[model samples]
Target: MDRIRDLASKKAAVIFTKSSCCMCYSIKQLFYELGASPAVHELDKEARGREMELALRGLGCSPTVPAVFIGGVYVGSATDIISLHVDGSLKQMLINAKAIWF
Candidate 1:
């Protein structure tokens, strides 16, 4: 849990992902399209990945992968992010977090 929090806080925007998850890929692409250079942590490639995944679950991430954090805050999984995007709140959140400008 401590490790997860530490990694999540390292950047203005962070995504906890699994290498092969298509939704993870899409979420990453969305951030790129929005011009936010978010830090990506591929759980499958990390040494303590399973542990971290469990920690993410404890933090309320249902699908586990593609968990997002902005301004060191847990945002949610892919569906939540997509909803935020559709509502035009995601971009504003990115800007407020300093993940993107203008």
Candidate 2:
């Protein structure tokens, strides 16, 4: 828990995205509304991004847009993020990931 928080605090949230992905945009907007300045990594722009995509696939996540990471935890796609917000679980997840206002 502390580790997750530390990572979130240190790195901000990492949102893996692609420029042409609508879900990515939604996720970014949602996070902004949640008061989180998430760092976006475009997975179609660099070699490292490709590596990240492969890694995510290896981790059992869908190889799609808007793969969000809070702290170091995989938080799934844009729809998943929105659901978390709707359920009021997004903030808690962020806190668990260490990305909350202390």
Candidate 3:
């Protein structure tokens, strides 16, 4: 969990994901489209992957891949991402976090 938090607080945005998850891919693409270079952690490829995922669950993230964080805060699961996007707050959120300049 400490490692995860360190990674999160390292940048404006972070995504803990699984490499093969389409949702993870979509999330990465979304940030790319918005010109934000988020730190992406493909947990499935990490040595402590399962441990990290479990730690995330303890942090209130969904029991799934694609856990997202902005400004060093845990945002939510995939649904929350879509909701933010639909509500038109995703862009502003990124901007406020210094994840995007334009």
Candidate 4:
């Protein structure tokens, strides 16, 4: 738990993702299109993937793959991002988190 929290705060924006998940891919693509690079942790490819996933679940992000964090705050999953985008707030959130310059 401490390690996950530490890593989440290591960057202004962070994404815990899986390499082969389409949702994770979409999140990465969205950030790329926004010209922002989030610190991505690919759980499926890591030795401690299960442990981290459990930790994330306990932290309130169930189905934790592709979980997001901004400024050390948990920001939900891709669906949440899509909602934010629909409201035209995702960009501002990224900007607020210092994930993008514009």
**Top model number, TM-score:** 1
lDDT of model 1, residue 24: 99
Kindly list the per-residue Cα lDDT of model 3 for residues 1-102, writing each as its tens digit.
898899889999999999989989998898899899999999999999999999998898885579989999998878898899889999999999999996
Ranking the candidates on TM-score from highest down gives: 1, 3, 4, 2
lDDT of 2 at 25: 85
Candidate 1 Cα deviation (angstroms), residue 6:
0.9
Which residue segments of model 4 deviate by more than 4 Å? none
**How accurate locally is residue 59 in candidate 1, as Cα lDDT from 0 to 100?**
88
Candidate 2 lDDT tens digits, 17-83: 8888888888888888777888777778856667667766766667557778787767787778888
TM-score of each: 0.98, 0.78, 0.95, 0.95
> Number of clashes in every candidate structure?
0, 1, 0, 0
Q: How high is the lDDT of residue 56 in model 1?
A: 97
Across 26-82, the per-residue lDDT of candidate 1 in tens digits comes to 999999999999999999999999999999999888999899999999999999999
Instruction: Give all candidates' CA lDDT scores.
Output: 0.96, 0.73, 0.91, 0.89
Q: Where is model 2 more than 4 Å wrong at Cα? A: 1-10
**Cα lDDT over the full model 3:** 0.91
Clashes of 2: 1
TM-score of candidate 1 versus the correct structure, residues matched by position: 0.98
Query: Candidate 3: deviation at residue 3, Å?
Result: 1.1
